[model samples]
Target chain A: MAEKHINARGLQCPGPIVQIFKEAQNCAAGDILCVEVTDQGFKKDIAAWCKKTKNELLSLEEEGGVIKARIKKG
Target chain B: MSENKKTIIVFSGDLDKAMASFIIANGAAAMGNEVSMFFTFWGLNILRKPEKIRTRKSFMEAMFGWMMPRGAGKLGLSKMNFGGIGAIMMKSIMKQKKVNTIQELIESARALGVKMIACTMSMDVMGFKEEELIDGLEFAGVATYLGEADEANVNLFI
Candidate 1:
């Protein structure tokens, strides 16, 4: 399985999600993407995006004020 | 599930409002929804060229062009403008937060296939030249906007 990492640490709401969407374009159906972000709004945004896009959100974690979301492209 | 179209009438040219409108447009487009934005009156200023294009125009037309904000980058805040300083401060905050600027958001929306329609009536009334606006815009009248709005599942007047 392929994996991708997106450093969205400094990005705000929708910026990180937009970046994830852009990156997800090149990935295969089962590829895993890890997005690192600092925006608190992303907690809900990513979940909603994955739900809308029919992707699988594997995990969401926060560490030292940074949020990381692991998603599997569907 | 079939109601997936979103149409927005962008009536304000203020930076913050424009940013909000574009953010919504982009988000909707990202979710595979059909998005259309109609620019009217002051909203047309968001699509103007950043630099003066030096097009030949009548004196009144020239004055109108000079008085309006040149482009997205030059737009002022809708509130607490503080003589243009507020816009500058807002830009700084956006940068620090890594939020896309209004210009960047517009580009993203376009790239996401959002239909950007410029109101010809507003353009004529506001003295905006066809060549002075950005590329890739579809020009139409109120009928077209109304048609799109009528079918859109989510219609907004901003």
Candidate 2:
């Protein structure tokens, strides 16, 4: 499966999620999306979004101020 | 699985409020939720056409239409506006922050298939004809908004 990297840094609420959602739409069912966001609120938002969209969250971690998440599309 | 529905009543015409409502609507729609935004009262200004359209109006209607800000681009902030300067500053900050403007958000929401409904009663009160507003909007009354809200899991009044 192909993998995509999304840099959603410097965006506020809904920006990061919107970017991820838009990118995910162009990907195949089994593709992987690695998203990096600077919005602190995105930590919880991403989990909730992944749950609602039925995407599998591979890992979520924070390095410095950026939050990184890997999600496999379901 | 059944799709979730969201209904938002956009009652405020302030730039910040409009942005908030659109942001929520766009986010919900992107998450595969069916989202509907009902524009009523002052909120109808968000859907107004920037360019003046030739429409017959009474003296009072013409005055009201003239006084109200036309379209999304002319909207002002609800607080600390300093007579529109705050709105200009806010737009600059939004640009620097790389955040989408209200126009872009509305376009994105439309692209995401979010339903936008303008309140017929408000249009009547405001003397706004269909041609006076932006295109791609469904005109309806409160009953229609209530019906949409009834099926929605989340209902918000902004």
- Cα lDDT of model 2 by residue, B1-158, tens digit: 23599999999999999999999998998787999999999999999999999899999899989999899999999998899999999999999987889999999899889999999999999999999988899999989998998889899999
Measured with DockQ on alpha carbons, how good is candidate 2? 0.62
Tell me, by DockQ, which candidate is best: 1
Q: B1-158, model 1: which lDDT tens digit per residue?
A: 14778999999999999999999998888776899999999999999989788677888888889999999989999999898999999999878767888988999999889999999998988789889999999999989988998788898989
State the TM-score for model 1.
Answer: 0.93
Enumerate clash totals for all models, in the order shown. 0, 0
DockQ of 1: 0.63
Stretches of model 2 off by over 4 angstroms after superposition? B1-3
Query: Which stretch of 10 consecutive residues in model 1 chain B shows the poorest summed lDDT?
Result: B1-10
Give fnat (model 2).
Answer: 0.59
Error of 2 at A19 (Å): 2.2
